[model samples]
Target: SGRVDPVTAARIGKVLGVDALILSTLTTLNVAEVGGISVGPLTVKGVKAEVIITGRVVDATTAEIKDSFEARGEEIEASIKVSDLQGLSFGTTAFNKSVVGKCIREAVENFARNIISNPDRLMTHQIELRGKVVKIVGSKLIVDIGSRSGVRERMTGKLIRMVEVEELQQYVSVPIGEVQVYSVNPDTCILEVLWAEEAPMEGDYVDLISLK
Candidate 1:
């Protein structure tokens, strides 16, 4: 609501295949030199840096605020030797972004620790996959989910198919089989069949359910 707009929430829901979503926001990520600095022929430059970062967790569907956190970082007062106080045009001293990066990391990690496992946060490791099986090799079931989709070794999935019954007039993707990731590439993953009610044939549906 405050951060995730309707279009963004819809797009994210499509990707996650979930009716709800947990949203994280970076409210503040800023860095500045607090101490005074002497420029151009005056004198020296003082280096006292300050960083502030804030994070907020929200529910995309309910438009509710779940949690919020703040973290701060600072660089102690230091001296930067001036090569040329009165340079012709530009000097070669550049402020480093790493200090601000540290602050952001602290803020984000703190936020994750506080809210990731909370029941109200609605966080899950589940990954939704929608693609057809390409081929099979012995007990191995290879699919189109791979590094790009965050697939890794030892990850598992459930094989399902939408079947229709003339009497019921509805389609369902039942857990016909279970599979484990054996190997993976950038855009492909090889899964080893663990159990199946019936042998899975080519062109079947493969759902790499989750990473955690």
Candidate 2:
């Protein structure tokens, strides 16, 4: 029933280099005492609890709360009946264990759902491309990728060589150079080669190296 402290949230956001935070609160907890059975002279008791969780997503950069929602679920447990007289039979112990497990699972699920629904809270993007090298002129290597897939100027990518082995009859790729996009068109870009052992060819695979 406690909100995540602002100081703690800020620290977490700073560590993750993100601009958002999520806060959760437990609103309701219902406990029910289910009937128990007797094995010989000892009587066992069973209890089940249902929990409701609520949360909110906030943008730490702007200090604005983005979204909020509530989730509720009942604890799960398997039914058991006492059978033996002298020894402890299937009874309240099993139900209590199940209820605890269910509560933990539900809490985890609610936390994960809150994270999955908020996209703006997380902002690391990466893409791998397979395209023709097209041409290499002076200090630039032209590849066949564009702004449609988030390729932009100043972004760094890796130029890889895909080689087909004749004896092994398989194709493999190896990193040959790193390049930064200097200019970008609608469907292509000119990359400035930063480091390379061999010049890129007309057809080669490129991979986005710096994701952040």
Q: Estimate each model's TM-score.
A: 0.41, 0.43
Model 2 steric clash pairs: none
lDDT of 1: 0.61
lDDT of each structure? 0.61, 0.67
lDDT for each residue of candidate 2 in 1-212, tens digit (9 for 90 to 100) = 46466566667777887766777787776656655545457666555567777776656555456667777667633343222112423345643356644664576587677678765444333346554578888777788887766677888778889888999899888889987888878888888878888877778667764342
lDDT, model 1, position 48: 42
The 10-residue segment with the lowest total lDDT in model 1: 84-93
What tens-digit string does per-residue lDDT give for candidate 1 at 1-212? 25665457656766776655545445554444444545655554444434455544444454444455565555433244223222323222322333344444556566566655554435434466655678888888778768887787887778876688778988778779888889889999888888899888887887776523
